[model samples]
Target: MKAIKSFSIGLIFFVVSSCGSLNPINPLSLLMGNSWALSSLMGKSLDLSQFADGVPSLNFLEGGKLAGFTGCNNLSGSFALEGSSIRLDPGAVTRKACPGTGEQDFLGALSKVGNLKIGKDKLTFLNGEEELMSFIPKED
Candidate 1:
């Protein structure tokens, strides 16, 4: 009887400690060579193409350097992972501004991103708790 109680307590402790492992992987780690689409803009979900020319791309190299497309133009930025939150810095990009509402909208969305989420097989950018963009892993 005492053995059963001890085993139960040990099982509970193991489960609790492992819970943090389920939090999810860093989004930047999953962003490598992945093309991410804007699922929700500002705070709503709409056809991303309704305001953009192409799906944004995310590429991570051997090092920590990061680069991607901003739908309108190409951008390169540095990123760091803290637990599960992926943080992006103000990146340098092509100065030739893209025309049309889509380009403008894409650029605007990038500005509002705070952190990112990486799931088992997808990635997302968050504005507070709301998801702004989500990306699926692409086949190389």
Candidate 2:
């Protein structure tokens, strides 16, 4: 009885410790487990640090869904990726209007993204051959 109890506790511990691994592998799995923060937009190098509390990021989930912070409002949408080809459909996003925030510009760039390139520590989204946005992996 004591041995069984100890084994159960060990199993529970293992499960809890491996929770991070529960994320399934998908086409975007290579980009998963990382939050890519917006670094640049429309060829302009944005200084997001000056925004004080505004930090925008994109995270691709296991399914075809995506969740992101639009620098002002929260956003979630469906995405399709094949090889380097990608498309983002911003289906449902929060409509809270925060003046002076570049929410529209951010969403516009995201909608124009037709391809993705994952670098050593960065992620780049492109519209055709032109780079639309560049991102750096957020620290865990």
Candidate 3:
């Protein structure tokens, strides 16, 4: 009886310790697994799957960095997260001109995001009470 109790306690400890900080249950893991493409911008709907080129996408990299394509430019920036709040700083972006690309507007909306809401297959960036950008997980 004594040995069984010890083994049970040891098993529980091992299970709990294995789930430490890097567990898949962490929200960041769920957010990072998919690169998200813009579904809408400032209430204007867009379907990125239909676009032949210049499809904007967003990725949340590890180590508090955000990197993605801005339809025409590659952008990388630091992101601040506090509890449920988030802010994606407008970082460096290549300035090569791509006429008719919505790079500026896309980056603009990202900079304004004050929080992020993750749904089943969508990511919504919000500024205060307004939805600034909407995205759906992009296919691998």
Candidate 4:
């Protein structure tokens, strides 16, 4: 009878410990397969009407690929993430005669991104602790 009780306790403990081993949601899962639109840059809110090609946006793709628009030009790049650290490399940008300086500003900010913050509804790029750009979920 004592052996039966000990065996039962061991089985219960094993099941409880196994439940804790289940992985929690990964933060990277939040970024992948999501489209984010630029809402602010350098502490200033953007006026989407001012962009020639609508608001700038980013689509994080699988396998470390990135695709986006720079308000006037289409942007393609690669990104590497290690924990919260991020490196954004702007690869090719379509050369179109853009009116305002929004595209330039966007690219410049992208180059400066050294870290990232993912909030409940926002993605913010930062150079160290200073925010360089902020994005929101792109409307479907």
Listing every candidate in turn, what is its Cα RMSD in Å to the true structure after a full C-alpha superposition?
Answer: 4.2, 10.7, 5.5, 4.0
Any idea what lDDT model 3 has?
0.78
Error of 1 at 32 (Å): 3.2
* Candidate 4: tens digits of C-alpha lDDT, residues 1-140: 99999999999999999999998655578787469999999989996655788899998888889899999989898999888899988798899988888888889999999999886588999999999999998889
Query: Over the full model, what C-alpha lDDT does candidate 4 score relative to the true structure?
Result: 0.88
lDDT of 1 by residue, 1-140 (tens): 99999999999999999997795454445566465554555555555555345665666655666677766677787777666566665378766556556556655666666777676566777778976666666555
The sequence of per-residue lDDT tens digits that candidate 2 reaches over residues 1-140 is: 99999999999999999997795544376677688888988888885643333877888887888888877778788788898899988778887766654777788888889998886588899988899999898876
Each prediction's whole-model lDDT (CA): 0.65, 0.81, 0.78, 0.88
User: Per-residue CA lDDT of candidate 3, range 1-140, in tens?
Assistant: 99999999999999888878553344476577889888899878864543335678888888888888877778888887775588887588877776653666777788788987776687888998899988899887
- Return whichever of 3 and 4 wins on lDDT: 4
Error of 4 at 29 (Å): 1.0
The residue ranges of model 2 lying beyond 4 angstroms of the native Cα positions read 1-27, 47-53
Question: What is residue 44's positional error in candidate 1, in angstroms?
Answer: 4.3
Worst ten in a row by lDDT for model 1: 24-33
- Ordered by lDDT, highest first, the candidates read 4, 2, 3, 1
